[model samples]
Target: MQATLMIYNGTAAPDADVLRTGGVPLAPARTTWPMCGNTCGGPMQFFAHLPVDYGVLSVFVCQNDPGACDTHDPVSGANRVLLFPSAELVPVAVPEEGVTLLPAVSAITTAVVTLEPEEADEDGLPPDAYDLARGGWKWEPGELFGKQREVLGSLGGSPSCLGDDRLPECPSCSGVMEFAAHLEEGIDRRSAMNLGGDLGYVFVCRPCSQGAFLRD
Candidate 1:
């Protein structure tokens, strides 16, 4: 079976929820300015806002000490991921004067491709989330899998596989960093964050406000 490519151009609408996988992350109410755990004392940069079955997952990374904070450690304080329950979801609040909550939002260009089962299992690749997603889409499993989207929130509350299981160590604290996000090419296939048509892994050291990007 051959693969087919489908594209969706995401539009930027102020004060609107981005239904796609890639877009500015919106925060829940009552949360303070997403402060960097480092010395930045400023709001972290908004990454992606993914809608999952349980709720919306908002991701943010610190841009202040980009060189120091180990962006790979979950407890590094350089990045933050917040999961808001769907039932208790609230409107995103605006930041006070002079306090910036996030950078400018950008339109997303979603790139999706259908992976036939025959093509997905090539080379005896182990059954993983990607395989499950493709299977769910082709087999028409209702509720058990639901409609599979190109950009997924997170797989089983964990980062999707990127060909390897090795987690990098923090550059600053020397601790093993945590898998933060899995970024796939969404726009122009050739121009997606230089991922080279492979999955991108985002590792973070939360306390360090540092991050590392790797492609597999």
Candidate 2:
């Protein structure tokens, strides 16, 4: 939610310290996720289309970007929001001889995502793997419906593995997960179109043999 802004004056190797995976890896090579929106977390890469430039030439913070908020629900399979920077002045590379620099813009700030939760995740990808499969769906003898009802009842019809957040995790265990498979179109609320064919990653915890899914 909160982030540190960086108005780089020159070219720098995308903060190698940051991450570069997940999502559709846009083009122009300018959008490189350097870090989280708050602290040292995951890298959220996306050129925010904020109405104004906040003088944030670059940024390093939590993966949560304020200007580029695209609420995408992998489970609901909806759309992703597109947030941008709030900078007023646009900076460009003017190579004079062999050097270049960025013109000062505005000021940038960071804070917890006070913005109301968007309808969907920003990447347009499912928040988690199970998101592809609604909560409490069960398997049964020619009647997966009953089993599903039971599962839903067990989950208290929560329709979510992770609290109210919609972020999914391995209830059976805890740890990072590995992408198992993807169920794009055919799957009902299985995954977002952005990640349907390229759904979330599945993980089988080493400890409990439990599984978790990350839609990213």
Q: Which one wins on TM-score?
A: 1
Q: What are the C-alpha RMSDs, in order, of all predicted structures?
A: 9.3, 18.8
Q: Candidate 2: minimum summed lDDT over ten consecutive residues — where? A: 149-158
Q: Model 1, range 61-180, lDDT digits (tens) per residue?
A: 565545455444545676666655545445455344322333333344333434444433576654454434433543453466533433432332234454334566677898876665
List residue ranges in candidate 2 displaced over 4 A.
1-24, 41-142, 145-216
Each prediction's whole-model lDDT (CA): 0.49, 0.26
* lDDT per residue (tens digit) for residues 1-216 in model 2: 111111212122222211111112222235433333233234443221112121121211122332242223322212212223333323322223310111112221221111223345686733432332332233346764532211111111112233335444444453333222221211223111223233232223334434333344
| Model 1 misplacement above 4 A | 1-8, 20-28, 87-114, 117-181, 184-216
